[model samples]
Target: MVLISWYLMLPPPVFPPVKDASGDYKMNTTAPISQWIKFKTFKSEDSCKARLKKMPAFYKCIASYDTALKPAATPSTSTVSGAAGSHMQ
Candidate 1:
């Protein structure tokens, strides 16, 4: 009786949601971005970029996780560009 009552009172196990190397979690099917932005662990610049590369649209909604929380620099507007432009190649 006592053991049964104690078992019933115990709380369920709580597990931190699984996250990728960049600390981003799997996108929710029904509410993807809305749910993704709620995670607090992804408050780093690099982490945000990794997330962007994986799910760029997620960037449109959530605040930047950069050190300054500012938007990343805009990409070059050139219609034609490649790694060869700078040095590589």
Candidate 2:
């Protein structure tokens, strides 16, 4: 069986507050929602969630989905999909 890797997504820096469709103001993030970076890697979704629980308060994490592994015969594939966006120092 094939295995899919998960990512601990890190949110980009916040800028000014922006209004959404509902007319509620929210902190404007540096990157767009789709472009938010994937910070760390995990073997599975459950493991990613586990680490997020213990992560520092400063960081925000989101689980990554590997759509590449899925049965997508289409030719168009996102370069950033199913892969880590940033490297650790």
Candidate 3:
């Protein structure tokens, strides 16, 4: 059986609350969301294969966000699909 797993990190909130000089709460417009990243691990060769074969359309869905934070020069589609197809089969 093939072993497949991946960890995906999500972008943080766009705005974080801050305390102003007046002791009132306010949104920090300049606050950056890039610092706080949350991620979870997924491990399931059988489950992934089952889902892929049951619905080939899932490839398209996976490809949709594959290049989300990748560099401009990165090749997104082929790498993700190729890896999944090669492993699942």
Candidate 4:
């Protein structure tokens, strides 16, 4: 039936939480396996490991930056002079 074929194409309703070789769940297991993006596909896990060994190790980290800062308050020189004159009087 068409329904059966469609169901087969759909991603599994439940996915057992799994982790990739890197031990990061978000990379390949957090989402539907079909929806997960692959950086590179290899014929086998051994080939992938071999290729990874040849490549330099790099860490991927997330960072956030905020550019908003409060402006500095400045006192005018005239105000100081006026206050000094008042005190002298």
Candidate 5:
């Protein structure tokens, strides 16, 4: 079996209250989600693969954020479709 480890750290920052679709102060992109980051260590390539397969939610959450802090959406349909296809698969 493969073995891997994970760690999550939230930076010490106060996030402003942001309104969601329901008009409630909830944590979303407008909040300090960037304060939260994940650090992972893999024993080997196989271990990383196993972790990704077994814990897709964790993988998705960690990979969903953009390092550049740019808007996640683009103004092009083709680019959006390509990105969507890559993520959905």
Candidate 6:
């Protein structure tokens, strides 16, 4: 599942921006969550929630983001490294 598009790069506003605003200045020109590059890959999860309900509302559909991003998934095996010196005395 993947249907992401809400990153907001910035540097292209000012189309009557904010004087009588309807929508602009996306949280003050977003782009700083490590330069968020939103994904977009759909082959399932009901076609990524059926195109995430016609987009908008920070479109999102995650299946663990299609895997392979393990920053941390700990189960606390004593934090793993060496593991009590590999179970030796």
Candidate number of the best lDDT: 2
Q: Model 3: which residue pairs collide?
A: none
1-89, model 4: which lDDT tens digit per residue? 22110111112222466665787442222333343223454544455565556543431111112111122456989999999999998
- Tens digits of per-residue lDDT, candidate 1, 42-87, equal 4444554565565434333244332323334667756336544655
- Candidate 6: misplaced stretches above 4 Å? 1-21, 24-44, 68-89
- What would the TM-scores of all predictions be? 0.21, 0.43, 0.24, 0.23, 0.25, 0.25
Ranking by lDDT: 2, 6, 5, 3, 4, 1
- Show model 3 residue runs off by greater than 4 Å: 1-4, 18-38, 45-65, 73-89
Per-model RMSD to reference: 19.9, 14.2, 17.3, 21.1, 13.5, 11.0
The local distance difference test score of model 1 is 0.38
Model 5: weakest 10-residue lDDT segment is 5-14
Alpha carbon lDDT of each predicted model: 0.38, 0.58, 0.42, 0.38, 0.46, 0.47
Candidate 2's C-alpha lDDT? 0.58
**Residue-by-residue lDDT tens digits, candidate 2, 1-89:** 66567777655554565666887554334444455566788887787888888975544444445442234355434544533344322
The sequence of per-residue lDDT tens digits that candidate 6 reaches over residues 1-35 is 54642322223333455543654354323432332
Pick the winner on TM-score between candidates 1 and 5.
5
Candidate 5 per-residue lDDT, tens place, 1-89, comes to 53334333223223565665887454333334454544454445555555666652323223333353233544899888999999997
Clashing pairs in 5: none
Supply candidate 4's per-residue lDDT for 54.
Answer: 58
TM-score of 3: 0.24
The positional error of residue 69 in candidate 2, measured at the CA in angstroms, is 14
Candidate achieving higher lDDT, 5 or 6:
6
Candidate 2 to truth, TM: 0.43
Off by over 4 Å in 1: 1-40, 56-58, 61-89
lDDT of 3 at 30: 37
